[model samples]
Target: MTQSSSEEEEDKVEEDKVEEEKGEVEEEAEEKEHEEVEEEAEEKEDEEVDEAEEEEDEAEEEEDVVEEEAEEEDEEVDEAEEEEDKAEEEEDKAEEEDDRE
Candidate 1:
């Protein structure tokens, strides 16, 4: 009976060791899963930032194009005014010559 009790004790110790090893493996797997979740979240955040930057870039480009168009319109108005002034000058000169004649 004494020898049987010793054998049972040894068997119980082995069982405890196997349970501890299994627990360690499960804990390691859980840790890996947590790390994977964190990495995915970070990647998603980075992608959102990139998209925001792209939107800002596009907005700036559109503003530049609008400014260029406004400048072109102003230039066209100036040219038209110059042409009208030249036409008025020519009419005045022709009237003065007719009065002199």
Candidate 2:
């Protein structure tokens, strides 16, 4: 009877140790899962930031193109006005000569 009691005591101790180890392993796994989730969130945020920056760059480029086109149109208008002024001056000179004749 005494030997059987000792064996039963050893079995209970072994079960306790196994339960403790299992608890530790579960805790570690939960911590790892939490860390992985945080890393994934950070990665997603970085991707969003990159996309925003790309969009901003594209918008700036488009604005520069529009400004260039506006400048070109202004130059064309100035040239056309200069040509009109020259034509008017020639017409006025011809009229003066005919009046003298």
Candidate 3:
């Protein structure tokens, strides 16, 4: 009976050791999964930041185009005014010559 009891104790110790190793393996797997999830989240955030910067650059380019168009319109208006002034000067000169005649 004593021999039988000693064998049973040895078996119980082996079972306990297996359980402890299994628990450790499960913990390591969980830690690896957590690290992977954090890395993916960081990558997504970086992508979002890049997208926002690109949009800002596009908006600035559009603003520059609008300003250039406005400057061209102002130049056209100035040219039209100068033409009208020349026409008025020619009419005054002709009237003065007629009065002298």
Specify the highest-TM-score model's number. Answer: 1
Error of 2 at 73 (Å): 0.9
Model 1 lDDT-worst window of ten: 2-11
What is the C-alpha local distance difference test score of each model?
0.99, 0.98, 0.95
How would the candidate models be sorted by lDDT, starting from the highest? 1, 2, 3
Candidate 1 structure quality by residue, lDDT tens digits, 1-101: 99999999999999999999999999999999999999999999999999999999999999999999999999999999999999999999999999999
Off by over 4 Å in 3: none
Candidate 2 RMSD to the real structure: 1.7
Model 2: which ten-residue window has the lowest total lDDT? 1-10
Candidate achieving the largest lDDT: 1
- How many clashes show up per model? 0, 0, 0
lDDT of model 3 at position 58:
97
Number of the candidate with higher lDDT, 2 or 3:
2
- Overall local distance difference test of candidate 3: 0.95
Worst 10 residues of 3 by lDDT: 80-89
Candidate 3 has which clashing residue pairs, if any? none
Clashes of 1: 0
lDDT of 3 by residue, 1-101 (tens): 99989999999999999999999999999999999999999999999999999999999999999999999999999999999999999999999999999
After aligning candidate 1 to the native by TM-score, how far in Å is the CA of 90 from where it should be? 2.2
